[model samples]
Target chain A: MMDFISYTCLIVGVIFWFWGTIPLLSERSVLFKLHSLSVSDTLGSMSIIFGLLLKIPREWPLLVLAIVCLVLWNTMLGYVLAYCSSSGEKRENR
Target chain B: MVGHLIFRLTIWFLLTANLSWLNILIGLSISLLLPRGYTNPETLKEWLSILGKILWAIPLAYIEAFDLILRPHNDEDMVCEQVEKKRSHRLVFLDILLITFTPKTIVVKYHEEGWYEVHRVTRRKKP
Candidate 1:
C-alpha cells in the first residue's frame, strides 16, 4: 500500500514539475504565470513529500524538520520568482 | 551569471540540508531548466565560488529591490553606500541599488559611450 502511494506521489510530482514548465513558454503576463507555476510546484511537492513521510518508520524529528524546510524553500522560491518577474516588468515599463 | 550561480548553489545546499538523494535528480532537472554555465562548473573551487555568490546575492538582491520599491517618489540622486556587486563588475551598491529602487536617477554605464553619465533626472536636480 505504501509503495503504491509512493509511486502515485512520484508520478503526481513529476506531472506538476512538467506542468511547471508551461510558464516559460507562456505569452501571458509573467506575474500570473509565476503564480500558477508556484502553486503547482508547492502542491505537487507537498503531496509528494507527504506520501514519502508516511513510509519513514520512526524519525519524527528529522521528518518534521525536512517538511518544514521543504515548505519554506518552496514558498520562498515562489515569492522570489514573483519578485524577480515584477522587477523585470519595471525595467520593461521603463 | 553571478545571480544564476547563487541560485544554483542555494538549490544544492537546500537539497543537501534535507539529506536528500533527490539531489542527483534535482540537479539534473535544474541543468535541464537553466543555462549550462551554472551547473557545469569544472572544479570544487568553481562550485564553492558559485555557492558563495548565491548566498551573498539573494539578500543583496532583496535589499536592492526593497529600496527601489520604498523610494518610488525620489527623483533626486539616489546615491547610497552599500556592499559589493559582482566579479569584474564594479557595481557600487549605490548603482546596482537603483535597478530595484530609484532606478531613474541612475547614471547607467552605457557601453556606447563607455561612461557613466549623470541621469537626466539627477542632472535636473543638480546645479
Candidate 2:
C-alpha cells in the first residue's frame, strides 16, 4: 500500500508540473502565467518530495527541509517576479 | 525573540539532521550569532494563527490548482486590499506569500497607505 501511494504521488506531481508548464506557451500576461506556474510548480515539487519521504523515511529530515524551502522560496520568488514585472510596466507608462 | 531563535534552531537541526553534541554546539552558536533586525511586538496567538493559515493554504492550494486546470479563466482584475495599521514586515511578507501561493491571486504592489494591489484571475461559471 505504501509503495502504491508513493508511486501515485510521484505520478501526480509530474502531471502537475506539466499542467503548470504548458501555460508558458500561451500568449498570456506575465503575471497570469506566473500565478499558475508558481502554484503548480511548488505543489508538484512538494508532492514529489513527499513521495520520496514516504519511500525513504530515513531521509525525512532532508525531505522535510526541501518541502519547507520549496514553500517559502517559491512563494517569495513568485512575489518578487510579479513585483518586478509590474513595476517595470509602471516605469514605462510614466 | 525566543520564537525567532527557536525557528532558527529548528532550521539548523533540519539542515544538519544530526544529534551529536558537536553539531548541536555549532548550530546553536551559529544561530545565536546571526544578526537579527528590529522586531515588532506580535502576540504568539496571532503568529500561530497565521502559521495555521499557511498550513491550511497547502491543501487549499492543491484544490485551487485542480480548479484552475479544469476550468478556463474568464478575466483578470487588479484589486486593492486594505491592510491593518501597524503591520509588521513579516506579516506583509506572509500575506503576499499566501496570496501568491494560491493559483488565482498574486500581489502586484504594496502601497504606503497600507493597501495591497492584487492581481486576480476569475474563472468561468458552469452552465
Candidate 3:
C-alpha cells in the first residue's frame, strides 16, 4: 500500500510538472504564465519530495526541509519574477 | 527577538540534520552570530496565523491549478489592490507570497502608497 501511494504521488507530480510547463508555449502574458507555472511547479516539487520522504523515512528531516524550502523560495521567486518583468516593461514604455 | 533566533536555529538543524552536542553548539552559534535585521513588530500570534494561512494555501493552490488546467482560456485582468495599513515589510512579503502562490493570481508590483498591482486569471462569462 505504501509503495503504491508513493508511486502515485511521484506520477502525479510528474503530470503536474508537464501541465505547468506546457502553458509556457502559449502566447499568454508573462504574468499569466508565471501564475500557473509557479503554482504547479511548487506543488509538483513538494509532492515529489513528499513521495521520497515516505519511501525513505530515515531521511525525513532533509525531505521535509526540502518541501519547506520549495514552498517558501518558490513563492518568493514567483513574486520577484513577476515584479521585475512588469516593472521592466513599464520602464521600456517610458 | 527570540522568534528570529529560534527560526534560524531550526533551519540550521534541518540543514545539518544532526543532533550531536557539537552540532547543536555550532547551530546555536551560527544562528546568533548572523547579522540581525530590524526587529519585526508583528506579534507571535499574527505570525502563526499567517503561517497557518500559508499552509492552508497549499491545498487551495492545487485546486486552483486543476481549475486553471481545465479551463485554459480564462480571462485575465490587472487591477490595483489596497494594502493593509501599517503593514511591516515581513508582513507585506508574506502577503505577496500568499497571493502569488495561488495559480490564478500574481502580484505584479507593490506600490509605495500601499497598493498592490495584481494580475488575475478569472473564469470567462457565458455569452
Best by TM-score: 2
lDDT of 2 by residue, A1-94 (tens): 9999998999889998998898899999898898778756898888898889889999888899989999899888888899999989889999
Where does the lowest 10-residue lDDT sum fall in candidate 2 chain B? B118-127
Clashes of each: 3, 0, 0
Please give, as one word, the docking class of candidate 2.
Answer: high
Error of 3 at A86 (Å): 1.0
Per-residue C-alpha lDDT of model 3 across residues A1-94, encoded as one tens digit per residue: 9998899888888888998888799898888788768756898887888888888899887888888888888988888898898889889999
Q: Which ranges of candidate 3 are over 4 A from the true structure? A: B125-127
User: Clash pairs of candidate 2?
Assistant: none
Query: Which of candidates 1 and 3 reaches a greater DockQ?
Result: 3
Give Cα-based local distance difference scores for all models.
0.48, 0.87, 0.84
Scored by lDDT, model 2 comes in at: 0.87
**Candidate 3, CAPRI quality class derived from DockQ:** medium
Window of ten residues with lowest summed lDDT in model 3 chain A: A32-41
How do the candidates rank by DockQ, highest first? 2, 3, 1
- Candidate 2, residues B14-102, lDDT tens digits: the string is 99899999999998899889999996878888899899999899899999888887887857888999878687888878888898888
TM-score, cand. 1 vs. native = 0.37
DockQ scores for all predicted structures: 0.04, 0.86, 0.80
Instruction: Tell how far residue A47 is off in model 1, in angstroms.
Output: 1.6
Tell me each candidate's TM-score: 0.37, 0.94, 0.92
Determine the iRMS, in angstroms, of model 3. 1.2
Clashing pairs in 1: B6-B54, B68-B100, B68-B101
User: Candidate order by lDDT, highest to lowest?
Assistant: 2, 3, 1
